[model samples]
Target: MRPDELDTALNNLAAEHRLRQRAILHSPQGPHVRIDGRDYLAFASNDYLGLANHPALKTAMQQAIDDWGVGSGASALVAGHFAIQQQAETALAAFTGCEAALLFGSGYAANLGVISSLLGRGDAVFADKLNHASLNDGCLLSRATFRRFRHNDVAHLEQLLRDTPAKTRLIAVDAVYSMDGDEAPLAALLQLAERYDAWLYLDDAHGFGVLGEGRGVLFDHALHHPRVIYMATLGKAAGVAGAFVAASHSVVNWLINSARTYIFTTAHPPAQAAAVLASLQLIKDEGWRRLQLQRHISRRHLQSGVGGCQPAFGLAVLAWRVCR
Candidate 1:
């Protein structure tokens, strides 16, 4: 495209109030923040447990930096995967009750790598209509026949599953829908996956570290099946900087071998992984953060006067639904 064409597109976005811009953060992320030298009551972060600026995490990160410099310096397959990363992965697997876990640079990369590596041209992927964009992009990249059912409609999903003739079928959904903040029908979806012999992939990015007292939706609902693959992000509620996918040992082994995103990208700084280890311990031991999150949810509901009708829980990331 021509430079003028790009300029015109940007101008259109600005006119539509849809232009995206980055805010320069002058302070650590928390409930309140200073952006571009101006202080504001910030409710925009996904740091559900208010641990982003926790002193313990900071100390751990600093200690890690002291022990193991700043960068991983190479791709994970090329000697960048450090001891901290391995420890974090093991802890994540144990925390989620999965047989194994694989870490990725970010939630986006994790989703893309997992989906693309698992499903291919002859396979079929069924996704919730409201899943994150990364999931959808991954499906598209897989060269699979992608079908999206109505948001959280298990019946629609079953219909799609029943009709798909592909030998390999995969179902992808967000455990907690990010935009609407509603939980997915994981139990029902799992039942469908069992009946149809399809793989179930749950992206618990928003639910992890806040729900199930920090173990996430899978643990909360006892949805641990061999066919299920669980994914959670550390940058959000875990107060760290990476994502991990947990599943059966074979699944994780397959990802380690075949996921191009994991194979090619440099591992996240070892310091970040060290901090995540400390964050995980804090998440398991300090239950007050979860309690505080519930209080915030309750207070917001009461203040908004949406009595009895609890707004879908995004925990710290509350979005009010107003009726016109």
Candidate 2:
């Protein structure tokens, strides 16, 4: 393509209001925020439990920095897997009721690592149409026979599963759609996974530290099947940084050994893990935050006159409203 073509595309995007821009925040993350020298009630954050700016997490992070410094200095497989990371992983697995857990630098990395590591040629991946972009990219990277069902349509997924002849099949979905504030039919999906002998991958990035009294959707539904792989992001509801994939011991072990994203990338700062450890404790012990969030969501819905009508998973009904 010519340079003028690129400029024209950029101009078109700007003219169509599709160009993205970053807001300069001058204050910490919370319900209220300061941007570009103006103050506003912010509803765009994923910090559902309002713990991102918690004093406890800040203290823990500072103490961790004092102990472990600011960087891991190496990948986890080399010299970066510090005690803090291990502790955080243990806490995360326990909190999610999974047999094992492996940490990643971010949710996008975690999704890519898990999906790519698990499925490949001769295998098939069935995903919800509205799954996070990371999930779709992971499927594409794996070179698997990628199939997408209608968003949240378990029947379509089942039909696809029945028709697929791949020896190994994996189904991936978001436990709670981040944009729409609606939940997936995890129980139905789990049943289908069991019936079709497929692996179920649940990304609970928006649900962990908020739903099921802070344990998440899988724990709430009691769907701890062996074939289930659970992934949650810490930067969002956990009120920290990084992400993790929780699953059976063997699955986690496989990811640790085979997932290139985890193997090649530098580990997250040990201090962040320390903060996450503190955040997990807060998520478990402090129920009031979740209650407060629910109240706020209810009030917002009422004020918007949207009632309780649920929208399609992962599609935001009100672009500026804080539904997730």
* Predicted structure with the largest lDDT when compared to the true one: 1
Which RMSD values do the candidates have, in order?
3.1, 2.8
Cα lDDT of model 2 by residue, 192-306, tens digit: 9999999999998888877788998878899888999999999887888889999899999999999999999899999999999999989888898777666666665666677
True lDDT of residue 117, candidate 1: 95
Location of the lowest summed lDDT over 10 successive residues in candidate 1: 315-324
**What is the lDDT for 324 in model 2?**
35
In order, candidate lDDTs are 0.88, 0.86
TM-score of every candidate relative to the true structure: 0.95, 0.94
TM-score of 1: 0.95
